[model samples]
Every structure is written in C-alpha cells, then in structure tokens.
Target: MDAYKKAGVDINAGYKLVDDIKNLSNNKDLGSFGGLFPLSLGAYKNPVLVSGTDGVGTKLLIAIKANLHKTIGIDLVAMCVNDVLAQGAKPLFFLDYLGVGHLDNEKAKDILAGVVEGVSQAQAKLVGGETAEMPDMYTHGHYDLAGFAVGIADQAKLLSKANPREGDVLLGLASNGLHSNGFSLVRDILFKQNTYSLNDRLAGCNRDLKDELLRPTKIYVKSVLPLVEQGTVASIAHITGGGLPENVTRILPDNLSAVFDYGSWQVPAIMKDLQKIGHLSFDDLLHTFNLGLGMVLAVHSGDADEVQSQLQAAGEIVSRVGRLTSGDKQVIIRKDQQ
Candidate 1:
C-alpha cells in the first residue's frame, strides 16, 4: 500500500527489477526447474560440489553513504566465490539475494551491474537471485546483499587442513585496501578522528576516503586456481571478518601454527592510519583486520619460490609472510625491529 512506501519499501519496483534480470540469467548449467549442472563427469575419479554463501557486512553502509553501490555487489560475489576457492573449488555459478527497505529501479540496476561484473571477473555464471522489498525492515534507500556461490572440485583435489605441516611457507596475496572486513573498527577510528567524509581526499592515496574504503574485496579465483592444477598448494586461508590471526588459523592443521614476521611486508597506508590513530595494539590489529595481506596461501616449502614467482608474474602482490612452525595451533606475530 501507500503506507508501505511511506514506511520505506516499494514492493512494485522490486517485482519489476527481479523480472528484468530473469532473461539475462539463462545459464545452460542451471536448469529451468532447479539448480543445474548436467555435464560429463569423466575427468574426476570423484567430484565434490563445494558451496559457500556470504554477504557484505556493515561495509554496505559505507557504500550506501558514499552512493557507491556498484562495487559492493562485486564484494558480495567475491566474498562467496573466494571462500569456495579457498577449498580448491572452481566457482561454477552464483546466486544473489537482495533485501531492500525501499526499492529504487536505478539503484537496483546499479547493484545488478556489479554482480554481473563480478561474475564475469570470476568466470562464473549468475544463474538466479531473489530481491525482497521489506518496508519496515530497512531505512529508506538502504538495502543489504548476500550471495551464494557453488563450485566444483575433485574430492582428491580439495585442499585440506589435515596435513599443514611445520616448515611450510605462508605466502600472502596483497589486498587493494580493507577488502570487506574490519570496517566497523575502521569506521570507528575514522569517525573518532573526524575523517569520515567520503568526499574528502586522502592525503597520500590521491583518492577520496570513501573510494578507498568501499573498494571491493579482491576475488582470488583467477590468480590461485591454476596452482590447484599443480597439486602443490597445501591449504589456503581467506582472511575475512576475523583478520589474519583467526582466519589463517582456521585452515591450519592442529599440529601446525603460523609464525608471522610482521616486518616482512609493508602494511598499506590506510591500515597505518588506523594503527596510528586508534593506538590499537598489535594483536588487536592483526586479529581484527587484514592489514594488507588479503589471502594467505599455505604452500609446501619446496614450492614456495615457484608459487611466489608465478603469482608476481600474474601481477599479483604476493609475499612470503611467514612459515608454519611445530607448535600448538596458534598465530605468532613478531614485531618489526625499529
């Protein structure tokens, strides 16, 4: 009713937008009736379907505030796709769910554009999605996004934490910026320092703070997938909501631990700002944010150099951040010597 719009949900617009993408989402792998994958499975002795679902968290607030909605859809897709890839799966298809308090056609279109863009980048299909217009649930012009990604990998090829051993190298892939995690703390620091305006230009980055903040989470699907073919990759950790310490530890086997020499790589300027302003301790920063490294690759010690060279040649910012050590499952962060 009219009151629904007044309350912030525009149900009619939501219906039309969903109809708009239906034609564009025709995937041969996806069935007319159900989620589909009807291909010859002659290659794998055993094929395992891997799936992951994720949403861009409160970081959507930053995008919404900056009026930059396109890339967050990229973040949504990347978040889900990248996670499945961590398990050594090849992303085959993706589906999204959008919930908006009120619907605006232009805004919905922009968001879908991003999803399409991300799917294209990841070489995955946008099979289908859901858009909900729930008036009372969100404020006007505010919406949230979540995505589901399905990938496939041979059961024997799946990266397992069962054998992450001591002396293995931790190769880190660089992040563009914050990459969809640690925004809450970052926002707090910026606001407390009175630096929340997206329009304001950052001093050294030569871009608006909003531009830097809302940068989409990097999709590691392209860069790391090839390595899976080599069978040298032991495990991977997609550093997300719980920063390096927690995330890296997640994929590490019980007999293994990470010994990070924090000085090994340069922390990006944006994170440096937070560290300086918040006076947050080392552990807090490492456990709460990616800092600079976005994805960590746990590779066999013999394959470390080759992997690093391959990644760098691919124009990826890769570094040997640390090594696995013989210890209880723990993340050891060593301070840079001043």
Candidate 2:
C-alpha cells in the first residue's frame, strides 16, 4: 500500500471519485483545475456578474443521522442560487465543495446526484467543484458541503438598486418547511432534549419527522426572474438565516419599515409544532425559522396585483403579506389585521 493510503488519504480513491463526479454531473471539465464558463454578453448591454456562496449548515448532521444524502445538495445549491436570484440575476453556473475524512464513492455519487438535480432546477450548469479527503479532519462517515453560484443580470435591472418606498406592498412566496436554517435548535429540541427518533412523527405533520426535516429548500429563480425583468419587483429578500425580520430589513431603506400582516399567510404546521413543543416564543420563531415565507418582494401598490398574478401564474403560492410604512428601519408583525 502507498504510504499516503496507509496514512488514510487515498489518492486513487480521490481520482476515481473525480471521474465519477464528472460522469454524475455530465460535465467533462469538472476534474480540471478551474471550471470554464463562456460569457455571452449579447443578452445585456450592461451586464453584472452576481455570485453567492452558502453551506448546508448543521442540517447536514440531520441528513447524515437520517441516512438521507440525496437531497442535501439541493439545499446547498438553493442557498446560493436564491441569494443571487434575489439580486435579479439569472444563474449561469454552480460549483460545490465537499470535505470528507474518507472518500466513500457511493455516498459521494449520491451527493453529486442531488447537486445535478439542484443545478437543473436552477437552470444552471455544474461547471466545477472540489472534493477533499482529509483523514482526521472529519468523522469517518461525515462530510460537509458548500456551494457557489454565479449569475448574470443587466445592471439596470438589479434588485438592489430598486428603492423600496413606503406603502409598497410586500408579497411573500411560500416556503418548503424549515429550509436549511435553525436546524441546530431543531436538533436540540427534537433529539437532545426530547429524545425523539427520526421515525417519530409530530402532530400536524403528515410525514415521518425525517421527511419534514430533510425537505429541500425551495428555489425561487424561475418565479421571480420574470418579474425582475419586467421591472415590477422593486426589491427582493431571500428569507434565510435571520428569518423574515433580518433578511427583509436588509433591502429596506432607512426611512421605511416592513409591517407584515401576521396570519395573512398560513405558517407551516412543522414550524408551529416546533414552537409548541419547544416552547419557543413568537419573537424567537420570527428570528429563527422562515415560518413559511421563503422569499419576500417589495413592489409598488399599483404593481402588487399584477406581480402577484404573475408569480401565481409561475406556479408559486403568493400572498399579499403586508406593506412598507413610514417608520424606523425594522420589521413589525401586526396580528390585528390582514
């Protein structure tokens, strides 16, 4: 045996996995030092390259524990692509990084299959990625995933340049359960403190607890990009880590505040179950999980109905959640009225 293989880093295994990844993603250039992408500038006179990178977070722990490896890569791609999409960009290509202690070919292939599915969902190509097998760096069966997505947008149509004004209507797109955030708390509440197994089903949830927990994050590219091109969407927020309050407030101007009509959109049952069982406060829930809305858009009141119509026509569940108001920079969840 080679000294390196004896020491735990198997070069042949890494080489074989690379070939398998290339085959899985159907990209022959994946094993190259750098991923190649051809830029076609004909689409926009003033094109801007938008890039975003994110990881699957501790959600991977759950995936590993549940032995569900196929869809976690979707969460990885969604996390990065949606952020770029929030800026009104069209995803062009994606790259992923995997770090593992040992290179298990089947497990690696399963992960890559999900990445391919995610790239397909985003309408992006999997150009390149890295898989590092470092013995002792990770547990024998555990690996981590991170993804980077590059997109293109006309400079004139960037969502960040859209100035959100007071009275602008807030439109929310439905989420697919807890989409890759607040899983640390979820694991603690469900497995640590409560000792619930992955097979255990909580009240109001139809599937086993594993299914709910491992649901891939929703990708919002196809639904929102058309609105962005039409200039109907003023600003967009990808609700992730900090939930609605923090993510929405990022796109808001200093003089305006976002006031959401709480209950206007139905919060997912899984979120409510976590709150009830975990004894989590509404404020905590607001700051942690998405609570159903994955992406929020700020549009002019006149364009609100049309934008909602367009998003619905694109097969998204839309809601007129709330509107911007003249106030300090903050998010206000009003339960009194819709």
Candidate 3:
C-alpha cells in the first residue's frame, strides 16, 4: 500500500464510492474538473442562474451517535437546494462533499443512497461529489456532510422582497421536525444537562429522541416551485439556521414587515418538548428554530385561499400564518393575539 493509504486515505476505495455514485445517479460522465449542465434544456430568453451551498450541521452528530447515516444526506441536499428554490429557481444539479476519518463501505453507501434519493426527489441531477478519507482530520468513524446546488430562473420571474405589498399574506409550509438547526442547544439540553440518551423515548413522542432528531429536512422545491411559476408569490423564505425572524427578514421590504400569529399554527411536539426541557423562551425558539414552519411565502391576499388549497392538493401541509404590515421591524410577533 502507498504512504497515503497507510494513513487511511484509500484511493481505490474512494474510486469505488465514485463508481457507486455514478451507477446510483446514472451520471456516467461526472469526474471532470467542473460539472457541465446545458442551458438549453428549456426556453427562457433572460435566464438567471442561482446557486446555494449548505451543510447538515450538528445534526450529523446525532445521526452518527444513533448509527443512522443514511438520511443525513437528505438533510444536506434540503439545506442547499431549498435555499436556491427560495429565489424562484428550478434546481438543475447537485454535488456533495464528504469528509471522514476512515471510509467504511456500508456507511459510505448509506450516505450516498440518501444523496441519490434526495436528488431524485428534487428532480435535479447529481452531477458530482467527493468522498475524502482523512486519517487524523476527523475522529474515527465520524464524518461531516456538505452540499452544493445550482438552479435556473428567468429574470422577470425572480422573486424578491421589493415586490411584496403591505397586504400580502404569509403562508407557512409545515416542517417535518427539527430540520437540521439548533442542534448544538438540543444536544446540550438532551445529553449534557438533561441526561437523555438518543434511545430514550420522551413522554409525548411516539418514537425515540434519535428518530425525532434524525428526521430529514423537508425539501420544498417541488412544493413551492409551482407557486413560484404561477407568479403569485412575491417572496419566499426557507426556514433554516436563523429560524423565522432572521430568515423571513431576508425577503422583507424596508417599508413592510411580517406580522405572525403564534396561535394560527401549531408548534410541533418535539419543539415544545425541547422548549420545556431547555427553558427556552418563545422568542428564542422563533429565532433559533423553525417552530414547525419550514418554508413561508408572501403572496397577494386575494390569492391566499387558492394558493393554500392548491398547495394542499400538491401534498404540502401549509398554514396561513402571517401577513405583511407597515413597520420598521422585519418581523413582528402578535403572540396569540390572533
């Protein structure tokens, strides 16, 4: 074996992962210096390319602790693709980066499987990815995941905050669970302070904590893209690391802020459990986590009901959670004064 192989960097094994990815993604031509995607797939006179990148965050620690590696890639893909989707882009291709101390075959396969599945779900191509086995860089049997996604949208169709009016309604799409954020706090509360194991089933949760924690981030591309294409959406926000306040403010006009009714939607049980355990205030929860809303849209008031019904028919659990108002604060909380 070579010196690098002796240091746990296996060229052959990594190539094996490449082969698996090729077969899994059906992209035989993927090992170039840069990935190539044709711009002629459809017709758009003034095309604007959009791209985004993100990682799975500390949620990977929970997955690794639980020995549940398959679904983390889904979270990786969701974190990346959904961001690009927020700007009314149709994601075209995806790539992933996996850094590990040692490459275990079954574990690598499981991770790649989730990536392939996520790409299929987003209707995008898995154009390329990398799996690096660094001996001392990461702890033994531990790895981290990051992903990149590129999308395309027309100039006129690009959604922005400037277009949202004062009367626009904020429609919130429900999150599956904790979609890969606030995990450092989650781990601190659950493991460090509360002494709860990943195997420990909470009082209200049907499954164990690990299952709830490892629940994959929902990809909103398929759900929100149609609404974007219809020209009904003024702005879209993907609820990620910064939660509602920060993420929603990204797409809010200076003259218009969003007013949310906490009572208009139900916070997920897992989140409530986290709040009670950590003694985290409601403001803390809103800024730190999704609080059950994954993707929110600012749309015309007249089209709110139709958008909700159509999104429901398209298999999305959506709620009319808020509205745009004249304010300097980007997001104002009514706190059950609905």
| lDDT tens readout by residue for model 3, 1-338 | 69978876788888788888788889998776777787774668799989999998899899889999888989999999999999999999999999999998789989989999888889899888888888888994789888999999998888876689988999999998999899998999899988899988877678989898999999988878888888878889999988999999999878888999887887888888889999999888888899899999888999899889889998999888989999874787788564
Task: Note the residue pairs that clash in candidate 3.
Answer: none
Task: Please rank every candidate by lDDT, starting with the best.
Answer: 2, 3, 1
Candidate 3's displacement at residue 29, Å, is: 1.4
**Model 1 clash number:** 0
- The root-mean-square deviation over C-alpha atoms between each candidate and the true structure, in angstroms, is 2.6, 1.2, 1.2
Full-model lDDT, candidate 3: 0.88
Candidate 1, which segments miss by more than 4 Å at Cα?
1-12, 22-35, 192-195
- What is the Cα-based lDDT of residue 211 in candidate 1? 87
lDDT of each: 0.83, 0.92, 0.88
Per-residue alpha-carbon lDDT of candidate 1 for residues 125-234, written as tens digits (9 for 90 to 100) = 88877778776688847898999999999998999987577899999999878888888787788776565577775555657888888888899888889997788789
State residue 248's C-alpha deviation in candidate 3, in Å: 0.6
Please give the range of 10 consecutive residues that has the lowest summed lDDT in model 1: 24-33
Report the lDDT tens digits of candidate 2 across residue range 190-257. 98879899999999999999999999999998888888888888999999999999999899888899
- Deviating ranges (above 4 Å) for candidate 2: none
